[model samples]
Target: METAYTIRKMEKSDLDQVHEIEQLSFTVPWSKESLLYEIEQNLFAKYMVVELEGKVVGYCGVWVIMEDAQITNIAVHPDFRGMKIGEALLTFAIQLSKEMNAKRLSLEVRVTNYIAQSLYKKVGFTVGGIRKRYYTDNQEDALVMWVNVQ
Candidate 1:
């Protein structure tokens, strides 16, 4: 069956659903308050959510400054993994970054997260470097990846 979903800018009302997805997808999930701050207070933040059959299934956030856009976080509901929703979210972020005049987009993924790394590579992101002990949860190193979006 074909998967149908809508991607749109995240709003305050979406935070509860987004937070649920975040908790399901991440070992270190962002708090609802943090998401609220990103949507309502952070000027550099741009966030989007994907709704599947009217339920929020995934979300992505980025911080754009000057010519650089840094992906803050991305997650899809655990029940929705392997459905290419993460890929779609990343693609949307790239296009949004380009429209905002960002020439480069970067994000860090856990070195052990081969699935996420593969998705990033498929989207043109290359490993730029490694950030030692980048993940606070287990002190795992992170692979810093970047792509030219312009």
Candidate 2:
């Protein structure tokens, strides 16, 4: 079953929950300090959080550089999986990239994560290349994907 969610720009209050989701969603989740650094100090970064009744359930982030936007991270809480929240977050990020004058968007997903690849494809991103041993935690390769905003 699908749950109602609201997507919006992340605020300082969401840091804790976002960090928790990152830890839950990834095998080698980023550190809380690193997330704080990105939120506090990264000028090129833009992030959004998804809430279900004011509780953060998912988040996505991207770095806008010149004419390109690179997705840095995206995750949905385990309990919220299969709710299409990830898809909504990706679409929101892509739309924001266009609004920020990005001519293209790129992201790297673990090669084994077919669900994510399918979502990217559904959102019009194409497989561009592969990054060998992209994940240090498991020595897994990544499928590089891109979407032209032109």
Candidate 3:
């Protein structure tokens, strides 16, 4: 049988596992304190997690502000990369944005991250602009992408 996974709103209890995935997936991962603040204090933040076999394996975060939504970050456990979890999570974010009355959603990806760009394109995202040296880790430029959600 194929493995099963579920996507749901994130909870404080999942922080440890989410932090682990974040660390494994990004060169610059958010701190545990930062995650907690986003979940508890940030009014615009909406975060979701994908669980596989009862373990948190991936997460996506977005900030919805009035008519515009911004995708802050998305990540999957490196071992779970090929399972379409990222696609599902992004779709969920778009649907959530729609429900929140957002007219558009946008995100920034490292210029070198073609894999992520392709996935975003699959979900209807197109190039919007670019940010110079958006990533501090290696000073990589970022490609801004956006999609109409309404």
RMSD of each: 0.7, 1.2, 0.9
Give per-residue CA lDDT, model 1, range 106-138, as digits (tens): 999999999999999999999999999999999
Q: Model 3's lDDT to the true fold?
A: 0.95
Worst 10 residues of 2 by lDDT: 1-10
Give one digit per residue, the lDDT tens place, for model 2 in 1-150: 557889998888899999999999899989988888788899999889999987999999899999999999999999988889999999898899999999999999999899999999999999999999999999999999999875
TM-score of 3: 0.97
Q: How does each model score on lDDT?
A: 0.95, 0.92, 0.95
Candidate 1: list runs displaced more than 4 Å.
Answer: none
Give the C-alpha lDDT of model 2: 0.92
- Return the TM-score for candidate 1, rounded to 2 decimals: 0.98
**Cα-based lDDT at residue 122, candidate 2:** 98
TM-score of each: 0.98, 0.95, 0.97
lDDT, model 1, position 40 = 93
